[model samples]
Structure formats: C-alpha cells, structure tokens
Target: MLSKSQIKVITRLKQKKYRVQDGLFVAEGLKVIKELLDSNLELHQLYTTVSFDGNLDREQRITEAELKKISFLTTPNKALALFKIPASKTIDSDQFVVALDSVRDPGNLGTIIRLCDWFGVKELICTTGTVDCYNPKVIQATMGSITRVNVSYLDLERYLKETRSPVFGAFMDGDIVYKTDLPTIGTLVLGNEANGISPEIEGLVTNRITIPRFGALQAAESLNVATATAILLSEFKRKG
Candidate 1:
C-alpha cells in the first residue's frame, strides 16, 4: 500500500521542478525497472505487482489497480521505479557522439537514446530546449536503454563551435550519406522534428549529410527523427 506522501512524490515527479529538486526520475515497466536495478544507478524505491529478487529490497508489491493509479503510462506497467538521476558525464568527443538540436518528441528522443546504447555510443548531447530525458514518455520508450546512455543538455551551437572535431548535420539537401566519408570521431547533429536544424547551428555543421530516399515518392516530407538517426548511425557503424 502506498502512503499519501509516497503518492505525492509520484505526482511531484510529473513536474520538472520536483524532479530536479529531488534528483530522481521514474522508470516504468518491468523490463526497464529490472535494467535500472542491475545498472550502477541507485534505486530509491520500487513499485511492483509481482515479486522478484534483485538489487532492491525496499520494494512494495502493490495491486495492479494501485499501479494504475500511480503510473504515468497509458496502460499501467507491472513495475515502476524511482531511480537516482545519475550524474552527467563530461562530453567525450574522442568517439562518435550524437548531438540533438531540439528534438521535441519524447518518443523520438528515447528511441535515439536506445539507438546510441545499441551502437555503443556512450554520450548524447542535447540542446537546452530538447525534450526532458526523464520525461515519463521518454523513459518508457527507451525500453531499458536509458540506463546505458548518458544524455547531457548543453548549449549545442556553442559546443559545436568550440569543439575541434568534425560536426555532421542531417538535412534533406545535404550530401548523400551513403556515399560520403564519415569520420571515426565527431558529433552528429539531428535537428527538430518539424522545424529542422536551427540557423544558428546550421552554420556549425562541418559536413551536411542526408539519407538517400527510395520507393514511393508520396509527398511525405522526410523520415521521422528516430528513423533518420538509425539510418545515419548504421552508416557510421558500417565505416568501422
């Protein structure tokens, strides 16, 4: 059973201020919760509907209806966990890194996080206006990849200008990525879902690259941001 105070904490996490103040974020679903338990991230509390043996001993096995009451998910998950927001690591430009320029959708951001983890990319750079990585939707979409990826919010344009490494931006009119030369160590910039890359950072791109389009030319504008990221990252991996 959840106390009124605990319910308030769950509600408070929905707001950014509370999340920042507490330095904790919620991770939903049994799979995500399990991954968080195994990772170096600390588990503040565990809310679950089933029993399992893992790193946490301070878990509560609430009823399914109780989980629904507290869950931010559309369909309540079997578990919800309060995890310590791990300290952000310093940006390492010595290897392939992804820079997100205001990717707004939580699902798109989360899928990118998963891709970064899958591709062994350790660091993610997000512009200040990008979607909160800890947002419930992003957490759910990451599907446990959140535990492995390090997402840092930064002044993207300034960082791009300061770093000596090559910066690549994905745009429709850019050079074809499949035929272009990709560097082993640099930043890849993916821009906003609707607005595309901002003009300030547009000039920061050392190489403008685009994924080749094929098949039906239905007036579809472009691939979704996450799909574009997968395509770009896959091409980079091919170079390795």
Candidate 2:
C-alpha cells in the first residue's frame, strides 16, 4: 500500500518542473531499473510488484493497483524507481563529441544517447531548448544507455566558438559525408527534426556534411534525426 504523500511525489515526477524541484527523476521497468542500480546514480526509492535480488533498504513491494496510481506507463512495468539527479559534469571535449541544436523529440534524443554510447562517443551536448534527457519517455526510450552517456545542456554556439577542434554540422545541401574528411577529435552537430541546423549555428560550422540519397526520385525530404545520427556516427567511427 502506498501513502497519499508517496503517490503524490511519484506521480509529480512525471513532469520536468517537479523533477527539477525534487532533484530526482523516475526510471521504470525492471531492465531500466536494474541498469540504473548498477550505476553510481543514487537511488531515492524503488517500488516493485514482486521481490527480487538486490533489494535495498528503501525498496517497497506494492500492489499493481497502487503502481497504476503512480505509473507513467500505460501498462506499468514490474518496477519503477526514483534516482537522485546526478550533478552535471564538465564536457569532455578532447574526445569525439555529439552536439544537438534544439532537437525537440524525446525519442530522438534518447536514441541518440544510446547511439553515442554504442559508438564510444564520450560527450553529448544539447542546447537548453532540447528536450530534457530525464524526461520519462526519453528515459524509457534510452533503455540502459543513459547510464553510460554523459549528457549536458549548454550554450552550443559559445562552446563551438571556443573549441579548437573542427565543427561539423549536418545539412541537406552540404558536401557528401563519405567524401568529406572527418576527424576523430571534433564536434558533430545534429539539428531539430523539422528544421535542419539553424543559421546561427551553421555560421560556426567548419565542415558541412550530408548523407546523400541514392533513390531515383530523391523524394524523401530528410532522414529522421535519430536515423541520421546512427549513419553519421557509423561513418565517423569507420572513417574518421
């Protein structure tokens, strides 16, 4: 059984403002919870439908009825957890970095983070306008990759201007990526879903690259940001 206060706190965590206010974010599903548990992130609480190994002092076994009251998912997963929001770390600019310019979709951001983890990209930078990485949907989409990726939100333009490494921005009309010289140590900027890279950020890009279309019609307007990210990261790793 969950108390009303507990219910209120957990349900409120679905919203970003409340999450920021409480200094905590929610992670649902057994896999997601387990991955987070293995990480250094501090667990504030855990509610589960069944007992499991690694149960902590703060763990609570709750009925499904109670879980539904606080769950953000339509079909609640076996477990849900609240973890203290880790403090932002300094950007690791020396290694390959992936930056986003107002990429608004939660799923895209989440997938990109997982992609970064897959390609061994150490740093992911997002503009303040980008969706919060801690958004529940984003957290769900990331699965476990969120634990390994270091995500930071900052002034992208200033960072690009200050960095000595080459800055590459994705665009429709830019030079084909395969032929372009991609350096291992540099910044790759991905743009919003509907709009490609913004003009202001485009001005700072030392290299402009694109994934060319081979179809006879060339009918498709653009690749999904997440899909484009995967392709670009693959190329960057293979050829950079």
Candidate 3:
C-alpha cells in the first residue's frame, strides 16, 4: 500500500531542492535499481510490484496504479527506489578530470558521466549552474554509471585558477583535436549546449581543441557536447 506521505516524498524528489532537503534521489526500472543495489549507494526505500531476491525487507509491493502515481517515467518501470545521496569526495586535482561549464541538459550530463566511467576518468567537475547530478532525469539517463563518477559542483573558474594542469576547452574553431599531442592527465572542459565554453573559463584553457567536420559542405555548426566529449576523450586515450 502506498501511503500519502510516501507518495508525496517520492514525487517531490523530482525537484532538486526537495531531493537535497530529503537527502534522497529516485532511480526507476529494474536494471538501474538493481545496478544501484550492487554498488556502494545506500538504499532508502524500494517500491515495486514484485519482490526482489534479498531486499524483501525494504521492498513495498504496490499496484501498477499506485506506481503510476509516484513514478517520474512516461510508462512507469517495474520498480522505483530512493537512495541516499553519497557525500561528495574531495577532487583529486592530479587526475584526468572532466569539467563542465554549465552543461544544462540532463541527458547530456548523464551521457558524459557514463563516458567518464568508460574512459576511466574518475572525477567530473561541474559549475554550480550545471544540472544537479542527482536530478531524476540525469540519474535515469546515467543507467547506473553515476555510481562510478565523482561529480562535484563548485566555482569552476576558481578550481581552474588553482590547478596547474593543462586545461583543454572544446571549441568550434580551435585546433583540430586529431593532430594535437594529448596528455593522460589534465582538465578537459566542455560547455553549455547552446553556448560553447563561457568566456571566463575559455581564458583559462591552455589548449583549445575541436573535432573537425569532414562532410563536404561542413554545414553542421558543432557536435553535440556529449558526442564531442566521446571523440575528444577517445583521442586523449589514444595519444596518452
């Protein structure tokens, strides 16, 4: 049975402030929830229509109608869970860090986090303006990669100013990334969807690189930030 209070709390988690205030974020679908269950994340609660093997104590079996009431998905998945947001770990500045200059799309940020996990980049730094990593949409898009990436929100400019790493900012007209000598350790900065790197962050970039267009007319203005991230990170790994 879904209590009014439980529904209220779960539905409110869709918003960032409520999530922060409650110290919980929601993950839906059997796959995502199961992956989270296997990770170090602490489970707050689990609502489902069927029982999970060992989590029967925490699981609350609810009807499909009850699930639809609290679910954030278009077609509710078989399960939804609330997990305690883990504390942000201190950024290891010496690592090959990926920085975001206000990338606003939840899907993009989520994909980028997955990319970081794939490429072994341990830390992801985002400006406060960037979407909350714990946003339900972002969490959904991460497909459980969120557990591996250490995402921290702070003043990006101040962090850049203090670091001695070679900052690489993705730009449309910057030098082609293919030819550039890439390093294994440094900060790679990606910017907003509509707006590229912000001017303040751009000033700190020691290397400005771009993925060049190979099409006949070169009509496309730019690669999507997440796609660009995939290409650039691949190049960095290849050259490292």
Candidate 4:
C-alpha cells in the first residue's frame, strides 16, 4: 500500500532541489527500472503493479491509481523506482568525450547521453546550465542508455582549457566535418539550442567543425542538436 509520506517523497523528487536533498531520483517504466536495478546505482524502493522476479522485499506492489499520483508522465508506466544518485565519476581525459555548452533541453541532453553510449563515448561533460541528466524527462528519453554513460556537470570552459587532446566545437560557419580529420580520442563540444557555442567556450575550441547540408534548397535553418550530435558521432566513429 502506498502511504501518504511515501507519496510526498516521490512527488518531491520531481524537483531538482528535492532530488539533490534526498540523494535520489525516480525512473519509470519496467525497462528503465530494471536497467537501473542491473546498474551500479542502488535502488531505494520499487513501486509496481506486478512483481518482478527478484528480491520481493525491496518491491512494493501498488495499484495503477496510486502510481498515477506520483508519476511525472501523463501515462504512467507499470513501474517507478527510486535509485540513489551515485557519486560523480572522474572524467577521463585519455578517451573520447562529449562536452555540452549550456544545452538546456532535457530531451536533447537525454538523446546526447544515448548517443554517447551508442558511440562508446564513456564520458559526458556538461556546463552548469545544461539540463540535469537525472531529470525525469531526460531519464525517460535515455531509455536504458543512462546506466552506460558517465555524465558530469561542471565549468565546461575550464574543463576544455584543461584538456590535453584536440577540442572540437560544432559551429555554423566552420570547416566541414567530413573533410576535417577527427581524432579518435578527443573532446567534441556541442552548444546550446538558441545560442550555439558561447564566446568564452568558443575561444577554447582547437577545431571548429560543421556538418554540411547537401540539400539543394537549403531551406532548413539548422539541424536539431541531438540530430546534429548523431551525425557528428557517426562521422567520428566511422573514421575510427
């Protein structure tokens, strides 16, 4: 049975401040919950309609009506689990990394995390302004890829400056990505949706690259940040 206090705690997790205070975050859907269960993240509690085969003690079977009360989604999934936010892992400067410069959209950040997972890019560095990876919307968008990626939020410009490998930034009037020689182990910095790369961060970019549009009309203004990330990552992976 879902208690009043339990409902209060779960509902409070929707806010970033509350999540930080509690040192936990919520993940919905059986798939995401199960993925987290298999991950290094510790499960604080599991609320679901059906019993998943495992430690029954940690699982709390609740009605769908009860789930709706705590769910952030309009259509609640079969399960929602609270997982402890593990300590941030140190960024590995030796490998390929993806850095975000104030990319605020939760969906975009989530998709980028998935992209990092897909391309075998283990470390993701984000500016303080970037949307929190643990945001319920971002967690939903990541599917199960969140468990495989190491994401860190910090001062992106300073991090870029400190990196020894070549730093690349995606820009509008930059050299074509396909023609440029991409390093197997380097940092690729992507900017915000509206502003693109900020000037402070721009100064730190060792290489400025862009994906050229082959469309004859060129009607589209720019690719979505996530879509652009997909293309850039594909190009980089293909070369290596």
lDDT for 133 in candidate 2 is 96
lDDT of 3 by residue, 146-186 (tens): 99999999999999999997999999889999888888889
How far out, in Å, is residue 221 in model 1? 1.5
**How many clashes (backbone N, Cα, C below 3 Å) per candidate?**
0, 0, 0, 0
lDDT of each: 0.90, 0.93, 0.93, 0.92
TM-score for candidate 1, residues paired by index:
0.95
For residues 152-210, write the lDDT of model 2, one tens digit per residue. Answer: 99999999999999999999988999998889999999998988888889999999999
lDDT tens digits by residue: candidate 4, 1-240: 898999999999989999999999999998888888888889998999888987657899899999999999999999999999999988888999999999999999999999989999999989999999999999999987999999999998888878899999999889999999999999999999999999999999999999988777757889999999999999999978
| Residue ranges of candidate 2 with Cα displaced over 4 Å | none
Better of 1 and 3 by lDDT: 3
The Cα error of candidate 4 at residue 28, in Å, is: 0.4
Off by over 4 Å in 4: none
* TM-scores of all predicted structures: 0.95, 0.98, 0.98, 0.98
Q: What is the lDDT of candidate 1?
A: 0.90
Deviation in angstroms for 71 in model 1?
0.5
Candidate 4 has what TM-score? 0.98
Question: How many clashes in candidate 1?
Answer: 0
